[model samples]
Target: MAVVNKNQLLDFLENRVEGHLQEAIRVFQNERAEILLQPAPDGGWSIAQCLEHLNGYGKFYLPQINKGLNQANRSSNSEIFKGSWLGTYFTRMMEPTTGTKKYKAFKNHIPAPDLDAPAVVAEFIHQQEELIVYLKQARQENVDAIKIPLSISKWVKLKLGDVFQFLIAHNERHLLQAKRNLKNLEVADKS
Candidate 1:
């Protein structure tokens, strides 16, 4: 992973969180349930499923990130963030524009087809708000020194900065997919 000024990275992540929040509020919130529940033309997950999938991840990661942030010691000096090789790999894999590869979600994270669209959108909005708070708190701590355990395995931990990068990238990927679903729905409706 590339080394970067900690503050710059956090700011970037915070911007992404804000974008996600706005997307939820401005786009998803106003969408009707039928549209949110409609799958893509290629039979992919619906918009509600996409948000619910992210919500599932937030359920596991938010508390862990908060715990890590609370336990982290304050840094008296500015620091640089350098991600581990595994962390870099994960973050890159999750990036929306990286590749066309389709990764399967863990069974637990796979959302049900019949989700309540309004509730899922509301939860996603709330999670993005919480992420903004975490990003702010992270500025006071040594992001490189704190480690957050992966949801996949407790033995595997990532630097706090890496966790933020990976989680935000994952969110971006799914949010892009959800937007694609919306576009497809619109095209179908016009036809």
Candidate 2:
């Protein structure tokens, strides 16, 4: 990850996350519930499932980030965040440019077939707003030093900077997936 001032990082993250929220809202306004829930022809997830999956991750990460920020010492604040090697690798893996290396959702993150599309969309928007708050809080602390546990394994931890980067990148990945699912639905409808 490139070294940037805290404000720049916050702006970049907020723009990326908010773009996802806005795109989802736009889809909700134009699309019916059935359309959002329609599975891809490839047997992949639907838009609602994609949003719910992101919500599952937010449910774990948002609170953990808040708790970590609350308990962390405030003696130091670095203007530039030097991301961890492991965190950077993980974040990069989640990027859409990394090709289609899919990972399993660990059961709990998987949304049911009967998921409510509107509710899932609302939850994702709420979570993105919460992430913005956490980013603000992070600006006041030594984000590079604070550690947040990975959802895959509690034993594995990452720097706060890396965690934010990974989460944002992951959000972008799934939001793109949701958009693609919607497009697939459109194409299938034509046939």
Candidate 3:
């Protein structure tokens, strides 16, 4: 996969991710619980649940990614020299859901809450806000240098930018899940 410039991608996220996120939130606000928890016949997620998961991991990685970005070239000891537990928890939880033993994008895994979105995403967002406080310090060249040995693959090092891309993709994946769920809801209603 082509690695986009961190600053460029960050700008893209400011508009694109935010817009999609706002729309998804609107869907959540309008959704009923019956539709949110269950998957459609086609195996898709409801809008509310998707928001929970999208924010779930973003909330986790934003802080770590920010830490790595902010500390670029300044100190040998970046806060994320070792990543946070949130990322680790996220992976373990998501394991049963996605059915993969290991992650390809991140050396350390980030998990999804096995139970629900609200609890996980709330934590995710709080840290994200903290990370955002110093986002200006983030730069592409610097972030690219950030690396960590893979927990699943000791030989591999996961780059910081790839983790960022994964977060964006993860959001989109859940957003699509929500859309598909919406369609499923419509079909169920029709039936």
Candidate with top lDDT is: 1
Off by over 4 Å in 3: 1-6, 43-56, 75-137, 148-155
Evaluation by lDDT, superior candidate among 1 and 3: 1
> Of 1 and 2, which scores higher on TM-score?
1
Lowest lDDT 10-residue stretch of candidate 2: 23-32
In order of lDDT, best first, we have: 1, 2, 3
What is the C-alpha RMSD, rounded to one decimal, of candidate 3?
Answer: 8.0
lDDT of 1 by residue, 18-57 (tens): 9999998999998999999988789899999999999998
> Per-residue CA lDDT of candidate 2, range 33-100, in tens?
88888887799988888888888899999999999999888988788887777988998889888736
Q: List model 3 lDDT by residue over 1-191, tens digit each.
A: 34345566556545545655465455554455556566557644445545665454554556556556655665442332222344334433343345245334342232332435444334434434443443444443455567544334546555664454445555555566667777877888899
Listed in order, each prediction's TM-score against the native is: 0.96, 0.92, 0.58
RMSD values for the candidates in order, in angstroms, are 1.1, 1.7, 8.0
Off by over 4 Å in 1: 75-78
Predictions ranked by TM-score, top down? 1, 2, 3
Error in Å for residue 169 of model 1: 0.4
